[model samples]
Target chain A: MDTGSSPKERVVTDQDAQNITRVEELAYELKISQVMTREIRSLTPDMNMGDVLDIFRSQRVSGAPVLVNGELAGILSIEDIIRALRAVDLASPVSKYMSSQVMTIHDYDPVIEALKVFVKSNYGRLPVVDENNKLVGIITKGDITRGLLNALQHVYHEEEVIRYRASHLFEDIISDRTSLILRYRIKHGDFTHGGNASANIKRALLRLGANPQIARRCGIAIYEAEMNLIIHTNNGGTIRVEIEPHQISLEAYDDGPGIPNIQLAMQPGYSTASEEVREKGFGAGMGLVNIKRCVDDMRLESSTISGTNLRLKIFLREKDAFADVSQQGKETKK
Target chain B: MKIVELVKLVNGTVLVQGDRQDRDIKGGFGADLMSDVLASIQPDAVLLTGLCNPQVVRTAQVADVAAIVFVRGKNPPIETIRLADQEGIPLISSPYGMFELAGRLYKAGLPSFEKSVDPDCSCE
Candidate 1:
């Protein structure tokens, strides 16, 4: 796996990162046995080189493992055949053309190990053997490429199916007014999970067929409110989002220790967060301001005894609407 | 500018290389406040912050930030790296301070992603 250069030393571009990461992961996870060709095309050591050329041409294989009584002995490649041709020894025995220093790979070893061996040894193929050293199969670079492509295609199909199902949620249901409500309970001072709810809401909106701009607006607004709950509440709070075809309503409310001055609290750079909270790069008094910027409607109600409640709404334009309102009206009439 | 080029400009080390390293950065936003980042940053912009925590990655995810650069060569915790990787947001650490990195990026033709706050808006 060590390619004489650490990851930090490599100049990784954004495109390379996305591509290499997936291929790298697949290489480490896939086993040699899983991607190896199980059928053996073995060549006996005593076979004539002329016969070997006939087998290679018919099988369309560049190489094969040389075996004696089903026991691994050596590998004969196209290069060796070329050498035999150059020497005018087509009738020579297979052992004369085969390379006895065969590099074999374990059946259970990760495909990445084979990749490393290939890079280091510049071998075109390797014989696969089980733990008992019995020849099980043969693996080529082409086999690994095909295996990775199959795995990637499988994942792509699954994700597309899920997206199709989720995007058609409103269309598949019959209701007078269809709305999906998502609720999340935020823990106070839990900085680690602060934006989790917002992330989920954004993902849900995207899955539900909302456009990227709309999902982003909702994400930013909800994120600010969620963070406020985590940073300023006595017992944390709950964030509830009711998503309709035309509008999205988001509400975050806490129990106690409410804001004393609503106007001041709404002001940018006005925060009552403790010194400790400020050290963590939050409590900058911009959460409410940011939420207001992202939402079309914003309402804040609070008291020292009753805590605070913030509600936000964004009305989707016709082009950005998640579902057809006219279709819903017809369904309601029926 | 390409993120790899930007990284080279600041002599930064990539902690988590996200899926899109070749993504062209439209602009840059330098802020430690997550809310400011959420409010001002436009999509495809690189977020440069002094804060090295998981929330920064969360904030980037919400804002659709192209990447995050930690100034002063500060490496975030493992959890932060994991979150950034999962979200497909690249994370880099620079040996320079926030001001220097911002200036260098700005000099390198990266525009600012910040939207100026409207003074008369009552939403605040």
Candidate 2:
């Protein structure tokens, strides 16, 4: 019985008086293990936090399986790093806190099942072990992201996959010639959201097709802006990112009591955050210095009555100014 | 059918309104991860997805999207909508299943974004 086009059918069939059985189908099909990279990155448990950070930065991996005597010792992830960094000083060994009890998947576990596990855990990579509990391969947050990307981008052309970064959207202006201004608002007392606004803009720039170097510079500068609020302000304050297409401007403000020594605070390793924040991978006292290193122009403003505010300006030489972006893209193989 | 017409077919409310009748729609893709969306989706497009977070709108902005249609009528939080409003992207939701919505859009003459238009192959 072929119904006319105008008559809408019940897609999700259920039991009722007249059981008209129609086969249900999946919206999108899944690919086999072929399209996914299952090779899990691992490190020995005895390695220190410095090693972990090195691996994360170099491999660009979100998680690593901790191998203790060839068995699944523990799992270390970005979240774990954040926790461990907050728990101890920078020099602490990673084994002191890497999660030993990790949730993983059998080789046969469906990707959707893995997705559910990740969603529940709020963690990024999943280690794949065999029935014998031996590490075989691993799946990353990047893998899942790739899977979903392939599913949704039905119209993407080959050329689109290899695309121009600026073809997307524009980020906040940093300079008039080559930079943009970035501003972020860090809500008072909200520790979790402090550096997010700045990171969001950086990631946003990456998505919008900005050059990676520009994005990183912006991220580094704004990261300092956000951290300054968390350090001196009674409550983490506000950060604003302003981009003038060619130039970038960043401003972070806090309602807390003002900084007595602006010059000292700007020095390398000059941190006022609790020892706890330092352990968590921040409060390095090097934040302000890092910002200065990233941007071409930087400024600061502080007041005891209202709040302490810091503003930074960065100028990115135009994309045409340097023909090197395409080369980096090719190397990253994105 | 045009996205404007499809918007009427579904129960989703519009967040960021934009030109709905751009004849450039070639296909649809749905996903929750913006990172992937950022890597792919390089053409005149419409994105079908359910996640209505601020990142979704920002992803669409970075993707240079034509419109976004939320499936299963999942209206996102208000903050997400506010962000979308700022981005000038339109959102549509439908009571229809993602499968039905996809099939309907395909059958009504919209081609898959990746669907080869070369008539020599003859899949059509």
Candidate 3:
């Protein structure tokens, strides 16, 4: 998988790499207790189907767990209600309509395990139980997705701070010279602005007369590094870029919570990113690998206590610059 | 193209008309999975799908989809139509399947949803 080949020549182009990394990350092993909704909307088995429909409408939920004497008995969903509306009287007790054999999950069970249940059974929500099969909470697809949205909101907030710093700190540090240096503070969980630093780096590279290919490679490399910080690390980090006449180098150093197994993290399908991050298109476990493909040289130093530091280097030369301009000229002539 | 023109292109019936049928759609996406729509669709792109459920409307709302076109003559449930009406999203239904509708729209010069540009960007 680590063979040296151009990205375009490889079978796995970036656009269709989903099949290569179809496995779930180990990080989604969070217990349902951490993410489940405890304020459950429940119903009694004795309630009439009409009243149950009213409850569902007023509560804005399509389903609720039915209880008998404060214990889990069955699950009542909109599908069941729809079936009941067709087969039974509207005034019939919910016990007659509700699904009596409920598939349950323990609060301590991993969320991925619950996800498996959702896939297999096609149930919208599952009643969360404890050691005694007592309903403590309920986990739904909405709950999991809402958690992802909440995490994304955190990323947005970090982007605000980074934007502020870019306007204020970045302006004061730059000088008009043959060689330039720029620094950006990257925040963990800052998915919203992960690409900004790399984009800025690419712009600066282009302005400094670097070839499009070299600039694009540097951009892809740093983008991957920035994403690594946002997805993997709890503590945010900083990106330092040095652009000289012949070469460009970028260094990213985070604070702590480094990779436990760098070897596994480097694997294409191995990722620590939560399921939420994967859905948003950031954590395919391909970032580091792509970075490696883009840069001429790369180094990674990581530890659980000291955190991870990544360095990438790309060379520039007159020949590459001439080649790009000549290529553009030939295309223009055509 | 205008929404009215799009309706004609796909031989669609507008179930609930929005305020802006004259509005030009930049591109279109077709998918039945609400999650895929939520993750990938750009704002204001028309969503073509066969799954007619309340969640489809809800996903369209969350993703800021311009309008929904139910393919293969699948009319949305009353619950879904109500949600779409509440969200101010136009709902259309067509007898044509997803692929046929997409091809018609493509042939009519509408961009593929994934390949469309961000209007906010300066690039033309």
Candidate 4:
């Protein structure tokens, strides 16, 4: 009856249209080119399905546009490829499998318009065309998501830099007595949280906009001392952290069996860790040596009764002083 | 060389289905050590390994390896396959050992990272 109603066209619901309008309004200032990938990889109609798969794998792309006579012909997507792989032979020509009626967007069009097409058709990507209807670019959900993430990160880093600048502005006013103290208790044999204290200090220093090299050196020194406390001590320990404008000092004090031979303990390949510890990717016998190399000044005090007290000082006054000291320490270790 | 050609060359079986079986493999790297794989293999290179642990798949994902072919007829565990699928990497299991599989692929025109002449190549 009535020739099956002339194969009724799929209708776009009112809600879907409304959602697209909102998307357009929100992205009114953004253009398709802003988020589209310019270097598009496309497929040819004559290429066999096997060739298509080869292109997909070598290029690490899930789908690609199909071009004919230097014009936009269609799109061959991953979903279509998967379906074809299951139903058709890999030797079939891609033209027989490509979606000829491809939905495309202009490169200069508003991003919101592309958003509408995407929501209505539920497509993963859209081919971008120029005025004369030639494929110029391709845009995927990944590109849009990455663009938004980069924009958000840029804004966040700007805010952090501004905040850091303001803090330095106040430092000049209170130049005489500004200091930050951080403390953590280290439990003996608590390998589960071995480097927690040092990690926290590193995070704090980074947030405060300290030079990355200085912060890294301080972190390394604290970590080595913390490992010593956990691996070699019996009665646990404490770490006191002090951060001044020009210097960072870390002290680890433990009430456990101390090192009997300080010189031997300072050697690069000397370790007293059990066999079980060595199997866990640690206790390489380079802990103290590495600590000494990372810091500007290091002091170790140990005795059988008083346990071990280690102080690591890193200077941040001269930008290159820490690096120079690191160089010297490394040569000495060699 | 195409991955399908590799499967035929080594008499291997494709375990987990991936996007493109026809993908071209630029080179092959054979190793059982994850660290060596990480330090040496380049992106889009196929890894030939006998290790079937989840870490193998994880390493491939991090290094952007195109595919992994398990040698010695070893099948990867389900967890490893799941990870590989999630990462969009293909998994192949070869009946041949690493040395033979590598030799077969090399003979089939797949280049190695070392850039040496194929043993059969008669050089002056």
B32-105 per-residue lDDT for model 2 (tens digits): 53433433343456777766555566556544556788787676666555555544567665666677776767
> Candidate 4 on B6-104: residue-level lDDT in tens?
766767667655545677788989876553453345556789988787656655654456788989878766666765665457787776788887877
Instruction: Give the TM-score of candidate 3 (chain A).
Output: 0.44
Indicate which candidate wins on DockQ. 1
**On residues A260-326, what C-alpha lDDT tens digit does candidate 2 reach at each position?**
7889977655767776564434565666665666567777777677777777766656662223334
**Better model by DockQ, 1 or 2?**
1
What's the interface RMS deviation of candidate 3? 17.6
lDDT of 4 by residue, A1-334 (tens): 1212122233433322322221233366567888889998978898888888888988999889988887878889878778778986889988888889988889888776777777788798999998887888998878766655555566569868865764454244443334678899989877655566776677677666676656666666676677678778887899998876567888999886989999998875688888766553346676776677667788999999888899988877645331233444454576
- lDDT score for residue A270 of model 1: 93
Across residues A1-334, which tens digit of lDDT does each residue of candidate 1 receive?
Answer: 2112223564544423443355678899999998999998999999999999999999999999999888999999999999999999999999987999898999999999999988898799999999999999999999999988887788778878877898888778867888999999999989988899999999899888898988999998898888889888999999999999889999999997999989998888999988878877778888888888888899999999889999999998878887887777677788
Off by over 4 Å in 1: A1-20, A57-60, A68-71, A82-87, A97-108, A129-136, A330-334, B119-124
Q: If ranked by lDDT, best first, what sequence of candidates would result?
A: 1, 4, 3, 2
What DockQ does each candidate score versus the true complex, computed on alpha carbons? 0.46, 0.01, 0.02, 0.04
Complex DockQ, candidate 3: 0.02
CAPRI-style quality class for the chain A–B interface of candidate 1? acceptable
- Lowest lDDT block of 10, candidate 3 chain B: B115-124
Q: What interface-residue Cα RMSD does candidate 2 give after superposition?
A: 16.9
The RMSD of every model to the true structure, in order and in angstroms, is: 5.2, 28.8, 19.7, 18.9
Each candidate structure's TM-score, on Cα atoms with residue i matched to residue i, is 0.86, 0.36, 0.37, 0.41
* TM-score of the second chain for every model: 0.93, 0.76, 0.87, 0.86
